[model samples]
Target: MTSEKRESALGALQSNLKKGHVYRREDLLISSNAVDRHLKQLLKSGVLEKLSQGLYYAPKTSIFGRLPPKEDDLVRAFLKDEEFLILSPNTYNSLGLGTTQLHNKTSVYNHKRHGVFKMGNRSFEFRIKPRFPKKLDKEFLLVDLLNNLNSLPENKDVILANIKKMLTNFDLIKLEKYVLLYGVVRTKKTVLSLLHDLR
Candidate 1:
């Protein structure tokens, strides 16, 4: 029977997810229709939650009843596809770096704007910016640091110290390469000088 099969499938999924890991829809299904129906049933029953349209997770329950991971983590988990990355306004706030005046909306960037996705109480606004630096190399890293700096408290010493620490781990050559490629002149100058002093 369809009901029996669905129950069996849900059980299998629940068992696998008991390890506290997240799984993508495709990874859990041999047939798409089966996944679709089963996911709908589970979501309705509150046995599973829709993190994103195609992404779902088993909620963690506590004395508070159900406790979800922070918004950023939920977004990141839902965005397991490498083509997209989650960029929440509270990314810095979630990481204890800053306070976010906007909590209801989060932004994400990849290569294309994928529209918006709403999951439970939150809504995510997705957009595509130019690709991030190839890896976490210095130049791109500085851009990331600067981009997230508004999250930090307004303390000059703390800001400079954080900058110095971030610079210490940078690759000057790669930084310069991206600086030239991206025309990030201000960051280029600041990082180059810092690298010179650190050397």
Candidate 2:
């Protein structure tokens, strides 16, 4: 492509830019034959930000300043698939189980990619799982809380005691369902034991 024509193609690619949306190099190639060269120019001009090797995003601005990419947008582009869940471990705090740990990490549960990946200023820990809830609910969080008990810094016995006392607060059936669906062996045994004691 001639320099003049290449600039025109690059301009077309830029016209379609959506703030807060991530794009892979392959996605941009559809619009510009001069991808590599134009990518460098775009990055240098701050029109596009490099997220990772082949991942890039158009920066979004707000009164607060330039906002980082959304968790879903970032992960979707990174995995190249939308079938994943992004959650913060701190979210479990809503359970009101005397847990107040704060974390700067993001955890992704998906059928693809395992291990930590740094994209821009954020860090996402991806774990491979054959299954995960489509969304969050109190019951699922309760089950997930137990599922990840070993990793919690709080005293396990205390939490268990509190759970037994608060057991009436959750739907027993949903709790059981999530446990059977998502729990590891230890969670299953612990939850079943707790339920059995109530009988």
TM-score against native, each model: 0.53, 0.95
Q: Relative to the true structure, how large is the alpha-carbon lDDT of every model?
A: 0.60, 0.88
Clashes (backbone N, CA, C under 3 Å), per candidate, total 0, 0
lDDT of 1 by residue, 1-199 (tens): 5778767876776566643344468766853346777777777987777766677777888777777656555655666555655554444433232243445556666665577877666777776667664333335545554554555455635655666775545566776666555544565576567777976
In model 1, the clashing pairs are none
lDDT of 2 by residue, 69-152 (tens): 988888998999988988777988898876788978788999999999999988899999999888878888888888888888
- Residue 89 of model 2, lDDT score: 70
lDDT of 2 at 101: 89
Residue 27 accuracy (lDDT) in model 2: 91
